[model samples]
Target: MTAPVAGTTPDRPLVRTWLYAVAIATGLAGAAAVVHQVTGRFWGDLGAYRAGAVAAATGDGNLYQASHLTPDGIALGFTYPPFAALLMQPLAVLSMPVAVATWTVVSVVALVAVIGLVLHQVGTPDRHRPATTIGALVAALPVFAVAGHLQVGQVGLILMWLVLADLVGGRHRRWHGLGVGIAAGIKLTPLVFIGLLVLTGRWRAAATALGGFAATVAVGFAWRPADSAWFFSGGLLDTDRVTGDPRTVLNQSLAGAVTRVADDPTPGFVWWVLAAVAAVAGLAVAVGQHRRGDVLTAVLVCAATGLLVSPVSWHHHWVWWVPALLLLGGHAWRHRHRTATATTVGVWVVLVASTSWVLAAPGGWDLHFTGLGLVYSNLYVLLGVAGIGVAGWRLRQPTGPPRPATVDTLSGSQP
Candidate 1:
């Protein structure tokens, strides 16, 4: 007789499962549409970019230039690099409403797909189906909200999915690296992952990313060398000041929070020192975990650390955590009765609640009141630190991988 697959176990009830998934997805879609129509924009950053691109295309001239109005300015289109502008060409051709709507839907779908894959990998037999659906739906709401609010996070969702897929042995690691590198060329923050690849001994993946970065820089320089110079000379430097402005409330980074707190100029050195120390420590921990063959943990820790340690980060950027969140949830479901499972669930609740509350808060509070953004930003930082701490503690514990004997006993085999 053929042997039963170990740990395959049982599945969830199909009918109820599908219904819940569909309802959640529909709700998210409706919310996205409602927000879009009411705001006359997708979300935050997205609205700014879509409007700026439209302005540029309409002969309104380069909106990133200082000559442009604050509402219309691209905020250093020069810093955007040519390939980024090139990537937006299609959207530039389309109407704002059409582009924003299309982008929102596509990003939402991508977020779902990534969550589904992560759930499948680590989910419990009973929870797999429901968790897959619910996680995706949960992630989608914030995803759509962010997109509708800022027009960012779509890239984040894509990058997170790509990195997870690659680490999970998908055949397209290089391609994913390339895509993320292009995103880095446009956004800068994604560059942190390159350090992760190197530290984790992924030489080939690192090479692929390096190649992609080079290619983007070359193409960008070739297309508009002057723009490249302008970007590096003025835009990158000015980003600090522009982002520090009280009106740009969307920034959720430690730097942004610090900027809001200072009455006059405080020592920038202090903030940089904190960020640097945190980053190094986080990277060391993540790399050590990766060396121990905990790819999922490594990725989760590193991704969270990247954002937490960055001098500048926005809430929309937190979208990258969807995969990690699902991974933690799936681990809980897979080991529902265990101590680790309880810890996982507790962390999930805290992180999810904190994130949801912060995202829903107004950007004005994020910009004007130092205390409000400080609370949100510090909450994220603390959670990230605590999570890595928990993960490290778990590692030190004597828990072993489930044994074949346990599987045999569970399956009612003679022992």
Candidate 2:
């Protein structure tokens, strides 16, 4: 870990007290926001999930066919697997308000845990007061996106935490890939992480992830054979059916950007070519980082790749940018690279300024891909590309092999 910044030692107690106060204040504010949201007409995205769960539980209709309107009456479809509906069945039993409140609290906690895990992965655990303070401040840069997802009751943050835990958790445990498998079962994007494990040469872990995913499919099949057949056979590949307009400013993936500019009968071919290039380049960087024993960096690189390659990576899905920013800032800080640090901070400013809270404001979508709107819409994809560049550059530099990280160290938690 890097040394504490000058003068921080004498003020350690005061700083700790201030941090505790800030944490409590933030939590209270978030809780109050949740309360207001529940009382008001905003159920955000939870309506879709809850409606699907209700359909599944009652067997009243096709789970995939169920759609719920927002308070504004915009119909939202349930795009997840049948198994996801099954998983959400318990929440379906609760009243809407209760379910919303419960989900908000759980998502908030998951967000906090993700911040902690990211900080630890970047070598800034709470035990290091100065580093922890810096991490907290840096972590705040992505709060806008996180809070946006929370307001919508989106599952992005929870999915992010699951992937982080699977990468950094339970190194000694046999089922290291179980979390990734389960998350993938709920939403298919996480299946990329299994490829990541394979690329990093964790063959056993890769096999375990594959097995777990198979188990999830089997369970879904047993529970709803027709739905499973429909989804697995073709429905899963139909991005247009699952997600909304690909040209929407909210989608930050390569396909989204291409869709905004192209009028081809099959623009998907362009997307596939771009995705192939990104996957090869990004995975190469991740594999290099892993070989160098920087597992955290490798994991993050793979995550960014997943977001970039996915057909419709919503602005909320870029929540992984939180950790990516922290890791880059930490690297720059530790190396005392002023230019790099400035660039890192500049990226954070850009991302935060372009958050869904800002870009998705009333009438903002009307702006489309005009001028600065283009930059804002494609920010996450650009960031992912930049990450790949950084990884490649780092791989070329000369350095000794990193010290072997223990299972506990990889887990990012105290034993």
lDDT of 1 at 149: 32
- CA displacement after TM-score superposition, residue 254 of candidate 1 (Å): 2.9
Q: Tens digit of lDDT per residue, candidate 1, span 1-415?
A: 1124558643234345545655654555566666656765334455445544554445454445512123433343223555566565566676545555566665655565565555555533433455456655665464422333334414566556556655543423335456556667766667787888888777787777778877887886776575566665666656553454522334545565456566323428767886787788778878877666666677787877787766656656676556665666666555565776676556555555554544433443444445455565455556666777776766676644631111111111212
- In order, candidate lDDTs are 0.56, 0.72
Q: Enumerate residue pairs that collide in model 1.
A: 42-148, 43-148, 43-149, 43-150, 44-149, 44-150, 45-150, 46-150, 46-151, 63-74
Q: How much is 60 displaced in model 2, in angstroms?
A: 1.4
RMSD of 2: 5.4
**Top model number, TM-score:** 2
lDDT, candidate 1, at 360: 37
Model 1 residue 288 CA deviation in Å? 1.2
**Candidate 1 TM-score, true structure as reference:** 0.74
Instruction: Write candidate 2's Cα lDDT for 98-141 as tens digits.
Output: 67767766675566566656656565534563456445544553
Q: Model 2 off-target regions past 4 Å?
A: 1-43, 129-144, 263-266, 356-361, 364-372, 400-415
